[model samples]
Target: MKLKELAHSRTGDKGNISNVSLIVYHLEDYERLRQAVTAERVKNHFKDIVKGEVIRYELPKMGAMNFVMQEALGGGVTRSLSLDRHGKSLSSYLLEMEISLES
Candidate 1:
């Protein structure tokens, strides 16, 4: 499945490092997301494309998650070429991700 299909919210540029925030509407879904998308797994998924580190942040208060991907664009901001046309596509991508709630 595509990364977008697994994320509740996602955002980033093509050539520059970016961060993708995800919000699991249901607690059950959050558990599934947590198990399905791991830092190592995510890194591996984008290993060929990204060149930096992939970090994950958990927010229990908001029941949300955040991913900070460094150098994923192949280069730093100075040399990266990735661009977000509307700056909102990332959220849409995240919403496309599908996961089952933990039982």
Candidate 2:
């Protein structure tokens, strides 16, 4: 499975970096996402494709997980010219992720 299938992503441009914000719905599904798609997992997924920093943030209150992937757009909005693209389509890329339930 791919990360894109597990959550919704929002892509934005900041200076020369691309920021991807991922939100996971259904807390129960988090287990699947965590097990399959971890911080290092994601980094490896985009290692050759994207060149930047990948940060993961867990939001228990919202029952969602956010990922900030930097430098994924080749260079930035100005250089990558991918700002017009929608990040939602990337959901299919994270379908294999596994998340655990809160105790």
Candidate 3:
């Protein structure tokens, strides 16, 4: 199933960096989400877009995770020639991640 089945996402951008958050709809799925979604996976998912590194921060109590992707904004809003200067499309891509519950 896609991550959208279990969670929703939000995104923010700053100076070539993109911050993405994935919040599980149910607390029970938090663990599964954590296991299936890793920083490495996120980096791979956005391989063509993100150039630097993807760092993931876990918010276990909130059933959420935040991914800090560096060099991902094509140089940020003020300078980004990309259509998604704010990185909102990145949020949608993140939610599209395929999740394996068995993992």
User: For this target, which candidate reaches the highest TM-score against the unseen true structure?
Assistant: 3
Per-residue CA lDDT of model 1 for 1-103, tens digit only, reads 5444444675765446567787766655566677777777666655655567889999866757777777665464456455743234545644544434445
Query: How much does candidate 2 score in TM-score?
Result: 0.63
Q: Candidates sorted by TM-score, descending order?
A: 3, 1, 2
Error of 1 at 103 (Å): 8.2
The model with the greater TM-score, 2 or 3, is 3
Off by over 4 Å in 1: 1-7, 12-16, 82-103
Model 2 lDDT per residue over 51-102, tens place:
7677777765565666677766656545655643433333444444444433
State which candidate has the highest lDDT. Answer: 3
- Candidate 3, backbone clash total: 0
The lDDT of each candidate is 0.62, 0.57, 0.94
lDDT ranking, high to low: 3, 1, 2
What digit string (tens of lDDT, one per residue) describes model 3 on residues 1-103? 9999999999987789999999999999999889999999999999999999999999999999999999998888899899988888999999998878995
Q: Give lDDT: candidate 2, residue 90.
A: 38
